[model samples]
Target: MEIYETQEENAWIFRIDGRLDSNTAPELETTVFRAIENGARRMVIDFEALAYISSAGLRVILKTAKDLKRLDGKLVLCAMQDYVREVFEISGFDTFLPIAPTAGDALRQVAPPKE
Candidate 1:
């Protein structure tokens, strides 16, 4: 999977392309953990380009969510395909994790309000 990351005012946005499975989950885990270690708080994962996700991928998201929660941070996920959304729903992650219909909505969840 390809991870494209950009920093907003108070959030780190990661646009994921390709599949997130056992092999690719590790790379994403590393990137996310590294960012958190470096003091990144809010984060958004854009799944617009992602075609598939495995249990390992869910684990990574769960772990990241927990980590961010401990730091009093937040994580938003957006632009998910129907099948992908079903995966998250079946996994019960949709209960706690914020899922937006669009990247703009996701950004709004983490972005500061305009004056």
Candidate 2:
């Protein structure tokens, strides 16, 4: 999977493309960890170009969300296709995480207050 990082005001956006599976989960995990290290608390994982996700990918996202939540940060997902969305639902992630229909919506939902 390819991860594109960008700054939207105070939030960080990660636009992922391709399949995030066992072979690529570690990459994604590391990328997210680096973002956290760089002081990014509000994150949006944009799945507009992502085709598939395995359990390993889910684990990475789950870990990130938990860690962020502990710090009073937020994590949101956007633009998921049907297969990916189904996997999340079947895995019970839907109940644990908040997903938005578009990247803009996700970003807005979790955007930090303006100074």
Candidate 3:
């Protein structure tokens, strides 16, 4: 998977493309964790081009969200395909993590101060 990150105002955006499986989950995790560690409180993860995700991928997302919450941070996911969204819903992630219809919506959902 490829991660293209950018900043918009105070929000950090990570646009991921390709598969997010056991092989590349760690790389993505490290990138995201580092971003959060670097004080990215409001993050919008774009999943429009992502084609797949494994259990490892799901774990990374969950852990990130938990960590963000501890820091009073926010994590938003946008433009997910139906297959991926189904996995998130079935895994109970949809309830814990916020999902917006678009990247703009995700960005707007971020709370102030930290963002």
Per-model TM-score, in order, reads: 0.94, 0.96, 0.93
lDDT of 2 by residue, 1-115 (tens): 7899999985899999999999999999999998899899999999999999989999999999999999899999999999999999999999989999999899898897778
**Minimal lDDT window, size 10, model 3:** 106-115
User: In order, what lDDT does every prediction score?
Assistant: 0.93, 0.94, 0.89
Which residue ranges in model 2 land beyond 4 Å of their true spot? 113-115
Clashing residue pairs in candidate 3 are none
Task: List, in order, the clash count of every candidate structure.
Answer: 0, 0, 0
A best-first ranking of the candidates according to their lDDT comes to: 2, 1, 3
lDDT of 3 by residue, 40-83 (tens): 98888999999998789999988888888899888999999999
Q: Which candidate leads in TM-score?
A: 2
Off by over 4 Å in 1: 112-115
- Return the number of clashes found in candidate 2: 0
Better candidate number, 1 or 3, judged by TM-score = 1
Q: Considering only N, C-alpha and C atoms within 3 Å, which residue pairs clash in candidate 2?
A: none
